[model samples]
Target: MENAEPFHDTRGFFDKIGSRIGSQAPAVAHHINPTDALLLLQNYEESEQGWFWSTDAAGNLTYITEAIASVLGGGSRALLGKSMVSLFHKTAEGDAGSRTLPFILTKKMKFNSLEVKAAASQDECWLSISGRPHHDRSGNFLGFRGSGIDVTAQRRLSLDTARLAMFDSLTGLANRASMAKKLETTLTAYRQQKRTCAVMLVDLDRFKQINDTLGHPAGDALLKQVAERLLKVVGQGGEVCRLGGDEFQIMLPDCDDRGILGDLASKIIGSLSQPYSVEGNRCIIGASVGMAISPFDGLTSEDLVKSADLALYEAKGNGRGRFRFYSKDMQQSAEDRRLLEEDLRDAIAQGALELAYQPIVNAKSNIVEGFEALVRWNHPERGHISPGLFIPIAEDANLIWELGEWAIRQACADAAKWPGKARVAVNVSPIQFANDLFPGVIDAALGASGLASERLELEITEGVFMAETNETNAMFQALKGRNVRLALDDFGTGYSSLSYLQTAPFDKIKIDQSFVRGATEPGSRNGAIITAIVALAEALGMDTTAEGIETLDEFELIRNLQVSHVQGFVYSKAVSQQVLLENLEDGQWKIEPSGPAHHRNDRLSMYRKVRMIHENHVYSIVIRNLSVTGALIDGLYDVPVGTKFVIDFGEGQLALATVTRSNGSLQGIQFETRLVSDGNGGLCTSRRVSPYLIAEAGLDVPNLPAGYVPTTKIERDSLSLPAFSTVADWTPTKARPK
Candidate 1:
């Protein structure tokens, strides 16, 4: 620092300081001299309140204070010859009360608190600088004289505060407010570019169970792990966010293909449903996804989010661990579900539910060994609703315990009146098994109905063992103490652990219907899986029952595999108690296995009204039986084989088919493209006609409940003649047609 040339001589520096202080002081302070002023300035430098510097007319540093020189290292010699702009740069791009130091110096202007950073420092170093252009006595520009103070700590604190406002502290993902802002901004910009975007809403299932059982700290750890997995699947493809408390949202830009979206949703569900290790405890949870596409679903952010939320509600309602795409009818479906929840509560109060028993028969002798009790609901207006529809509804509404307890007592009373030694199996839900008082419910039901405990079997799935805590083991022991039988239901479908089988006192292992239904297919591993399960059951002294045996081939394969029992439509569907009593009036009821000789495509029978278009002529048709590959229709008469028609299922779904068979008013048609699963045990088209295209075709898209027709426009004229006669009086039978 001493080798550098000073900008001011000692005499001139003292003279300037004395003149400034004398002008500002009163007459009594005139005794202050240049030597006194120079000593005072030296004292100020030693205090280290701030630093001072000067540059020549060419912007080369000429003088620097000792404190500033030492902080910059290499003393004053290294810094004196360096350009002022090269030594420091603007601290950041944007800030209040700040300007570029280079701009201020180039313009020869006075500035206050211009923040700059050291260009050569390894660590972050900030300085708030104030400077003025100094000129010679002739008014010629000489150089810049400046003062600076360290402000690095204040800058860092401000940056940290800004980050906290936009991110979640626990998971380190974008918060709700940040996500909302991003969605709004993106949509506003993309609307002008004619682009597409998609949104997915993911909700974690059974998270509360883990949270309540293990503790909050473990739950937090599990959430962090979930965030990591989501990032793995959606890397650089979209923005994944935490919407607080087990819910997450993802924004995918420039994607509108339903096939691609569905694949992503499935991947997310599978990844999240895997087991997590939290604090040395294994935890299992599931995820449900709902997706919505751009202009097709909605144009605005609010509408898109609402559509995604409705789809999420539908996905959860159908059953957790699945994904669903938004359709126009979902709004109505959600409202209907809300109404049905109320009706279910009333049904429980009025005792309007009843039990139907499906017999589980011996594979060799064909004699009934037991019956699994299934609940049936007959709504006054809707008629026989499927159990798949209402069971999930009951669970979500907190009505499962009430409905399940009623089922146990009702099954016991019904089984007591039977005239045989046949057992009755009742399904025990995970919610019921978790309650400590559930064993007492079982004991009371057996005592009140006077049914032997040995005749009542509780069917439990793998979900009850998710936690593997003492409570689960204690519940199993308590049931066993009552001399009741326990059957592991839906085996090989979930976490099939051989370790649990050894500890759990299970009397039987019921093979899941999924494996049985496909075991007879060509080149299927299900057959080998079934064989291994049977061998394992035999070794463990547990009886095995194969479920869903609907064909002779399946039944024969199961029998040859040495399965102890069989339960499915091959013997019979669930029958009412009165019918069961009539069959069991004589001791030892036996039946022969009678069903289709070969397995064919499983079709669902319905009387739904649809549209069939042939050569621009639209005709109303009623679907008799529907399957993924084809359907039977009753409307057009005398339609010859090989006639092509487009069938319109409502809500933008369309299928192209050709008539394969014709018999009177019935015509069987085969679809050109196979349908996909709708995630609710139903078939739907893989893609739908967008509403944007429908609007361009001169139709009110919002008011119509159907899709577009690609054929020439229909024009009613006097010369037009119908190709096929219409059957106006045809009606289906009261029973579902075969």
Candidate 2:
């Protein structure tokens, strides 16, 4: 470009190039005129739609058409000898891919429609280049001659398409495809390296309620907020992705320690479940996480994902806002779940479900101030099923509304039969609170039962206050207008525990049971928490109830905190309707504080029926309380101190024991072996008669048979039974009449 004369037109450029070439190769191209060929080639190079370029064997530009030079925005001489690779550099590779334009060119491969960017240009310009290797007649490589077109607009479009394929449109998180590919790659590599990876599948609880109430646009905003929080939590070590709707998947590589994984899951749940402010409206939701680890829970992507999903279902099934791990035994059969659902539906419809009232007593006078109505289901065949197991089922099957309506009607009717001063409290689920017909349901129940609204208290968790929408506000106002009291239940378990106190209309705050159980242990913060809760309640002019008060120390600490009411075994367990009414009629509803002065390890206040065996005689007894080390028993009259016996905690949990203290009908026995978790929130002995052993003994069923005979010889003959002093009777001082 520097040495050649400028071409006035295509004809001049052709004649100049033709005359020079003809001088060097007059015999080579005698068949055609070089001047005519140069004219046609120059004409082709001058088109605006395309540009022509050529580089020597070293890949530096030897020539570029004048039109491309103008597009590059410089004189033709400046770009003629620059490196072609330096001018239009290839960009970073696409996601998870290895092929790049630079690499392709280095291989000397012919390529078409390859995209490159103008690295030296000031403007962001993309180009599509097509090139092929050139060779002289001697077959020695000369350089590359290529044609390129400006693909700036087309490049943007292609990039946008790639982004959409990899990212969620709503939250801008990695889409399912991206997550799947990453998980597969991670698992495959980690398996060979023996490194661990954890997968957590998070499903938002009560998300549908928000979606239906606030509409989809608000839901989208809420999701974006959730995504932002997750990104903050996950940070650098892992990836967070949206798996459509309100479900999310998190991939953590090189992490399999369940403690750390559990902590992360808990943090995610807490963060995501916090109240969301979307479009100026407050929305609340919760998350349940299920986690699985590679090389243990599963080995492949599909298996691991399925395991995590199952764990998530269990977490939600156990209770919302919880996390569960994948265990081998968690493979629940579909038929069993179906049968359970059908039975639950039948139980609700046929009045097999009943409510038990646990008294909330005034701390000073121990008078029955209120009763928390807890639902129970007697499966008739499976015996008494726990509310923990059934409540979640009712929620999942959309049977909560029906069960809730029944609870209200039944509670009101039962409350009518109680003393006029006694009040009844019932729990309200998020669905029940959000339903438009809930107010009418309450009104009808109150009217039909002739129960005063003042005697009915509705207990709600902080989660119900998540939505500050107009409709949600109206519902609250409507309930308050009925003159019924509102109690904030499980107060300190949620995020923003203090925020709800400012706006939520609550007459009472129930300190969550989790905080009450360990208030006495060394360095336990729960005692201080109780004190703070009581002080806050006083400031807000609201009463506070300390729940799960099982020991004398807990009660004293709670009373010191100035908690107004106490609801737990230290007062009274939920009793039958007949028991409640009889006590009310007899004027014996007042309970006196009675339990161990100091909390012991692994104590549980379980009132259940068990068997006491002494000297080969089996006697039925009532276990008033139990612990890992011992139990307080009744129904055995005048049992002597140090009497050797076997305490038969049901399900073949036989504990070898010696009575340490005997007082009237009650005796304290210490177990020789500690109990272990039954995997269902209860405890059992370390060993049990296996079902196979039961059948081998010719039992009628695979259970401890009545009038049983032990095949193993008794060892009590050689053991020493300690003779200890009789301890003083420890019933409630008031009930004992001094």
Candidate 3:
């Protein structure tokens, strides 16, 4: 009995351990004594699968398994008196269960399967620890008794799986699903704070061609490069994510200004569109961006995403290298575009499409040398549809081949009847040029029309260079073998490569209209660019044509630049075949150049209804023409010069203007603040009325228009009489003048 004191003194510790597993140990103790149970506990501690731990009333460790102490390189006595919480801390990798270990011990509560890692280990080692409060028979508080198993391998597996789920494996950017969840959560929090957020959807143009040509590994490498470039441009301003393949998404918090968004979008487009060298192969691609802002565009992630997608579709439809912000009117335009595509499919069959030829005259003599055949679609309902609108649609709908073949045949046939040896140039889409059957189509057209091969010119663009050099050269040889003239069109618009000029057998280089439009302006580098282009053409034994010379200044600049040919409205609009023949009835077809005497800012003529406000009165007016600096409007009678008015261009755009000139039912007003580009070849105000203000004004935030009346109380006695009278019976002209 005296020697039994050793067994009796440790009886409580053994009992607590026994109760944790079940009553099995106590039942075995009824048959044997405490000595045998202690022996069994010692054997269990020697096995290192799991280690047992007990803390004193103050959370200091009283006992630790011998195996762990030795493995830790500090024997049992060195670690014995340390705090249990200090020995293993919560894992910094955000293990959820381990986060509560300290609090659980402070409150003296039971906890199970908590995760932690050793604080002093050289290599990371994680543990899954379970503990409960140990108490006396009267239920007074004692300390914690716990057991832990090494969970380092399992933790590594879990973290790896989580990373794969949340990030793109190839680009290492956030994946689509992770972005969606983040957007939703962000929107939810921002709604409570009444803050703004923006989203941009970017779709890469011509990525498929590169993918198909260069192989999948190259494509993957290109995507990684794109991601890196995006991060550099966006920096910490936004979260950039790859939404699989060629699509990416950027989320910017606390931003609502379209000007800033547009600039960022343009930078992204310009950066991504630059040539990329992947695996030593040069590749070019473009990007289109669609943007949406929260609380104005949508209140939820799904709705905002849809708006951005629609804007992206519009940007791609108009032109690939551009960006568009979400607008209320885009919903209708999208539907109309779909219907237009269907109508375009039937246009060739129904004979609704025709070619109109604009003269390409010699710059020195103003003598017509040839005509560039532009395809025109006269929709029965929509009147004349611009090629700028329909050409890309045809390309997307796969109708370009059929339409292109028809155009080549029609253009040759029309030129066969000309009185002189004037040539006809037909545009060649890259898609058509890539086809093996294109040469035969041209041969058939020339044969059927009896037009000379020397008089038929095919105008190709730099986009054709996307193909292999061997294939492109082969196509050029086949066309040249037929004595067909090759003109490289839109030479400086995109991906301009000297390599293309050196390889392709081009007889002419046409300066893009964009260069010519601004070449005469002061501080413009476009003139230098054109001079270089003209010099390059001359050095290569090729001719140059300047396109879209709409002013006398531009005409003179082209002549001074020694560009060989000029084509634009400065001479005349595109004429019908009948008109062309009538003009050709007289010999040589020499025409005098005439247009506006001086260069002016580009003005877009259209009929758009808008609200004009003077003092407290509002009147409806029609804008006949619009420009960045001013507009000519109708439906206001005899407005005096210097009279100020507020013009409302709907969807929250407002501008202050003063009348500079007036006539019966018409006035030309200059804007106090110049309008900025809307990025769709249009002008818009740089700022808009805030949706928050609209809500505060007691108006429906979503449906509010521009130029709302002030909510602040106004003294009626201080109001002035209206400056101008509305023209109630005023009728617009039947149509826009050509």
Candidate 4:
């Protein structure tokens, strides 16, 4: 190596340092020279702290100081002739610019202070490698010489810092910022390809209960299990991230099919809702999923995520443990929720809450054995309010206890007014049941009403026993001690634990309606569940009530299974206190049951209009009936059966259907995935056309119920155009064999 004009004054610097050292010590055997100084510097490079290394023209290590080779667990020649890049690499695999020793060597420029991962020692090693290019006098390329220092501890600290910034500390999943960046990247890339992606925003239901009941540590553990289950369900095709607290986001790439998305969402909900075993205690919870798709629901990440959030709000509000897709007309505004909450507080305070009674009929006698009291709210000015709407808010706002107390008292009082020896049943929330004062509240309600405890029933769900199992059992025993019948409501619907049934003081088991709804259908597994539950109830010496029996088929099935009681629309719609009183005054509790002889296979009568697209042509039709699997429609001109048509139910809702049966203008068409509950006594397709797309299509913002309407005018496609090649002078009877 040469310097410009003159070489560095190495000899003078050595001589000055040597004389100063000699004058101080005066006992040196020999004077130190530049040669000795160079030797000492070389020796220092061979120590454990630092090392010198060189690479050949081909980027293979020619020589590495003995210290580095020893640190790498070998003699001096072990790593010799190995690719220099093999010794160290970039901390992150995809990081660019000098990712490894070879990559930097390719630049062939003097470089310094490049950090690379080197796992040469027992602990992790990061090498700060510096290098200068060397060549012969003829300018022929030779190689590179560099020095490396151990920076293991510092590098690990930097990595830990980066991890804290990107990963959730509690759950070890991607944090909010990391999730946002990943979503942004995926959306941007997918948008370019015109491919679709789906994002599901999940909020764990009743997560706060864990924090309140157990502790934050247990909650943290539950969160970890939740992450693991999500990872198991999502697999490698999607990314699951914890966006803080109980909210998690799962991103599915290249997926836009709503049927698949809905199934996946349902799976996630089911998986997450299973009872969590935390520190030997069972904790039951649920999740609500809100899904939105890209380039359809949104073109940007923010818009898509916001759409998902809105859908999630609807899911939670409608009732937790369900999934909802983004829709333009969904009204889950915070102001509306808050306003309802405020009104709910006032309504309960004002005694505006009322109870509606639905009789629980004995399967054998078809007589009213007990009446289940359902709470209803009439907002004075707002008319009748649905419990589905207000009950969740009450739970969220901590007003459920007040509502529960009123319902209990009102139920008991109404039962006291009845002439017959009928019992009254009231549903209890887990929150209310968890309180130590629940037994006192029940006694007070019964006392205030002057009703016999034997004539009243307290219904509790399975969740009541999941946490504080022993305490819940104590509560159960105390309630039963009051001579009030304790019925387990919605049994086998959620996280059902047989242990609870074996131990808790339950007088009866109310089979959840989900199993009863389709039990009579051919080959339905619900029948098996119903029968099993009935057998279990009988074995445990508890009565069984099948709820939600809307048809005679369900009633007969319950009778065949020897279920004790039936409560559903088939018996009676919940009636006000006065209506119930008038019925009771007739002196008999017997009411004949009548409904459809058999299950409808989920088909329902409907009268609606929708557009049917056949071969790019739109036809207007009126749906005479609808079901999850298919629909019957009228209004089309001699359309052939077996023709595939896209059914447009407006607001971007589209379903592919085939005309399976056609007689005159009436036709039967089938859908893809069965329609799920829209949470409002309605059914809707999972995916909808975005409002942005509608605007781009130059159409008005429309609601879901409205059938497809063209931007200009809603009309059928004209059929006057020549649909195929036509001869200029061809006749029907012309000779064609020429």
Question: Can you list the residue pairs that collide in candidate 2?
Answer: none
Task: For residues 1-738, write the lDDT of model 4, one tens digit per residue.
Answer: 222111123343334445555565545676555457655755676456787777777787666777677676565567777777866644576755446556568868888888776655676666788999878678866788778887878877888999999999888889899989998998888755657789999999888878888889999999999999999999997988899889999989988667678778888988988998999989988899998888667767888899999889878877687888877666546557778889999999999888889988887887887888999888877788889889988888889998898888888888898987889999999899889998899889888989998999888887676575667778877988899898989888787888878888788999888888767667889888888888898898999998888998788888888888899888888888888788788655777888778776666678887887765356667888887788988776445677778899975788888888877557788886567655334677766655545654556653212454445543345444322111333355643322
Candidate 2 lands at a TM-score of: 0.75
Query: Native-vs-model 3 lDDT?
Result: 0.84
In model 1, where do residues sit more than 4 Å from their true spots?
Answer: 1-52, 63-77, 88-101, 703-722, 729-738
Error of 3 at 515 (Å): 1.7
> CA lDDT of 30 in candidate 3?
47
Q: How would you encode candidate 2's per-residue C-alpha lDDT over 336-408 as one tens digit per residue? A: 5567789999988888889999999999888888898999888878888877777888898999999999999
Residue 705, candidate 3: alpha-carbon lDDT: 33
**Candidate 3 C-alpha lDDT tens digits along 1-738:** 111111212345566545544544455534655456666876676667787877777787777676676555476677776787787765666566777778899999988888787877778888888888877767776787778888899989999899999999999999999999999999889877878889999999888877877889988999999999999999999999999989999999999877788899999998987778888777788899998888778878998899999999999998678998888989999999999999999998787898899999998998999999999999999999988889889888889999999999999999999998999999998889978899999999999999999999999987777635466778899999999999999888777879778878999999989998777888999888889999999999999998988989989988998899999999978999999999987647888999987778889999999999887777899999999999999998867899999998977788999999999889999999988777798888877776666666454555333554447554567756655667874346432111
**Candidate no. 4 TM-score:** 0.81
Off by over 4 Å in 3: 1-84, 89-110, 131-146, 188-194, 467-470, 585-587, 695-721, 729-738
Tens digits of lDDT, candidate 1, 412-514: 9999999878999999999999999899999989999999999999999887876678888999999999999999999976757788899999999999988
Worst lDDT run of 10 residues, candidate 3, spans 1-10
* Residue 242 in model 1: lDDT: 95
| Model 4: worst 10 consecutive residues (lDDT sum) | 1-10
State the lDDT at 735 in candidate 4: 34
lDDT of 1: 0.84
**Candidate 1 displacement at residue 344 in angstroms:** 1.9
**What stretches of model 2 exceed 4 Å from their correct place?**
1-48, 54-63, 70-73, 90-115, 130-146, 193-195, 333-335, 497-500, 586-588, 601-738
